[model samples]
Target chain A: MDRAVFFISDHTGITAEALGRSLLSQFPDFRFERTTLPFVDTEVKLRAACQRIQASQRDSGQAPLVFSSLANAGLRTLLMASGAVVFDVFEGHIERLETALGLQSAQAVGRAHGFHAQGRERIEALKFALDTDDGLRADAYGAADIILVGVSRSGKTPACLYLSLQYGVAAANYPLAEEELERVELPRTLRAWRDKLFGLTLAPERLHLLREERRPGSRYAALPQCRREIQAAAALFQTAGIPCLDTSNMSVEEIATTVLHRSALKRLRW
Target chain B: MDRAVFFISDHTGITAEALGRSLLSQFPDFRFERTTLPFVDTEVKLRAACQRIQASQRDSGQAPLVFSSLANAGLRTLLMASGAVVFDVFEGHIERLETALGLQSAQAVGRAHGFHAQGRERIEALKFALDTDDGLRADAYGAADIILVGVSRSGKTPACLYLSLQYGVAAANYPLAEEELERVELPRTLRAWRDKLFGLTLAPERLHLLREERRPGSRYAALPQCRREIQAAAALFQTAGIPCLDTSNMSVEEIATTVLHRSALKRLRW
Candidate 1:
């Protein structure tokens, strides 16, 4: 028999229930039952939740676990019946956060992580603009509060795109060409926006990981060129003092947030 | 001094690091410093990571709070020298899973969530076929391997979209119309694909929470309608014996996973 799981919560039970239900997808054999107590915000609700868990177990003829993000104190106790295990995602994280931050647990219940990703809106808009592939201009740098400059696989586009989406920052990025590197000078348009510019560089191995996704096994994926280009880019960012952040170890989200936080720019939110 | 929160991991640092980075974006005032020990397989790597943390403390003024997820044996000693409070995402999860499963700790050192969402390929292909104003299809109940039938604002679209993006599943959903509820008989097309079809229902409150995103205030947005629609639709699902999943407190991911798991269908890659 497939083991059953139940998801219960304090309010609007849909979302709280969903958080636990989603975990079931990973374990295909497990079955799920969800109950959302939206009307009652009292101890009675918790008792009701516990009763539902008991009923599900009795009906299913299996020990179905309950995963809840309960808000009310009564609800938490009601969910504590011993027929099956309970994994409370909300309370677990709330307790962890309290310990981590040296504070009391959160007053409310439910998953805390349902926010829009930072910089996503701005990233999407900028991606829309850059897809036009227009050349750099005087006003382009001015319109863009921050500019990302780097070699092809050094993680410019995705990082900039993430920034725009999560923080709503109008980020623009231009690739550093071989000639531009040879000249070793910022573009005339970017010279004025130097303080706002950020550079991304990566180790050869990471650049290779990225390039493999694009062209597979081409000269563009060559390690030597990757090393040389990364070195040149790092030198340029260092000399230019452009607040370069290496994308070698950072994920797409991490790289984007690092740039935004470091720049001390107002977070762009919708 | 602004708080310095660090997210570090031993394996697949990219993913673990990305999740942590997303969490940090919630706080704008904090000075976030992100560093990753991408492949902390050997003791040498562990020692080096420890040294870096020490160097960071001595170099920076603030005591960096480390959020680490390490699966290896030697990291505790290395991190002990850093003299900062730490919270590991996987430490508790690992302990619980081990005890529950009666298995030794896998010590899986990364955020490795496998792909288990159902129905993306058909949906993406439908995106190619999309030319409707009422959403995806007039005959959606006919063609879907799993048709998500729900009342409006019941999280059908996002669940379908997530199925399309994450698991490569071809998910289609049809809104429960007033006329359809009155009939409550399965639509002719739905009867043909009854085995493949599933119902998505949510608590009235959850339905309201979801609808709040699109239209805030109106008689259409009142609780009575929400309660009436949910009860009617759920009763309809019950009479039909169509497997129904409630989506109130759930995320898009949870809904999709629940359907895929319950249906025992292969999940598509998003």
Candidate 2:
């Protein structure tokens, strides 16, 4: 059986879509027909959305589902009159929060994507990630939220970028150089910040494949070299008691999420 | 007046918040209290969300707005019974799309955030962004989807990074050197691929302030120098007819969106 789903909002409707996709994923047996009606701040657009929902309900013999983030009372009333199942994204809860916090929301549109303090902070974090990427700027450890230590091509750069990009985290990554690995001790620059360190390791085969793309036929890309480095990096992480995740089978999203959870890092508000 | 808003989902509820925030912002006269109930896959969680919504309605004398993307029919039914306004984000629309395309959705959960072919493509784009940043690999320009040209502190790096991180665009950026800027022409290497080039210009004052932070008191941070560079860059863009946007007073989101839209670049499905 097929049902219609609508994501209605005054802006991009990106948020509605994200939440809708997630919720809808749980029902693996049913098929959904999805459409987004963004920039629906006007009464006409709201009525159009209502018509679409009603048409779907009529055609399919099921109540059409609506995922809406509408903030206007008049529009909400208009949507409700459609007689389709509606999910109001913000109505009842905003009142509770306002009462509890003793403050009124700005009731402004696109504030989530607008330029503000948090957005500035995120931009700064991205610049920090770029500046401190790949073990650059050794003196800037004091400013880092967390530092990732790993061997070459073990997926340090993307992991750090993801943390900053997704969470406004000021992440720095250091490549464990061969000389430092031979000594089998944490680098002098990182010793003071060991508490802030997380390690990344990749499978030998994966590491070899990634390295070969960058410096093919070099010792760095050789399978044996990858194995030795992986072993050494793992030993360093274990001996130092630094929390680590194997990136061999993990996406950057998974790695960044795990690292943040393990580190107990607080994500900046979205 | 204050109202309650709920972002209900079986996953992160991020989308509900985004679309919800955007929609509510348009009605700046009304204040909203907000809550998010994610992972509402179980009947228990769904009921908990309902109780919260009902309680808010009881207290506030207004129904809470619900932005949901529930895929499961049973869960959707359970949520609808709460007597709150509901928005079915996927059900009504997926069927329409399936009908139009003559295919059924996979009906999988977490498809938006899950690792798939798109994920691999994004990863590759990110790697490309890192490799091609700051005009390091001119020989690899052919691999780029778009190449951003700008002077230092004109915001090319962050723009490229945003394109790759959010949209999976293989964006490369070139920082026009002082010598090249004096020449008042696109660099020899870039001329061949002029069509792929996009220019970024920053406000003189903003550029000056930004440059001063890195190279304090240097000529590059001087107002006159900043003005000169901005003029030269704008002139170059005009002569070459390369599309450009001012980075000053624009968030990275705004810049990236404009560039992608103006350039007719395709954003990968997230």
lDDT of 1 at A106: 35
Q: Indicate the TM-score of model 1.
A: 0.48
Sequence-dependent TM-score of model 2: 0.73
lDDT minimum window of 10 residues, candidate 1 chain A? A111-120
My TM-score estimates for the predictions, one after another, are 0.48, 0.73
Runs with alpha carbons beyond 4 Å of true place in candidate 2: A1-107, A111-115, A182-184, B1-115
Against the native complex, each candidate's DockQ, computed on alpha carbons, is: 0.08, 0.21
DockQ of 2: 0.21
lDDT (Cα, 0-100) at A125 in candidate 1: 54
Segments in model 1 whose C-alpha atoms lie over 4 Å from true places: A1-49, A55-77, A81-83, A88-102, A111-270, B10-60, B73-81, B111-113, B116-141, B145-160, B166-169, B172-270
Would you list the C-alpha lDDT of every candidate in the order shown?
A: 0.58, 0.76
Highest lDDT scorer: 2
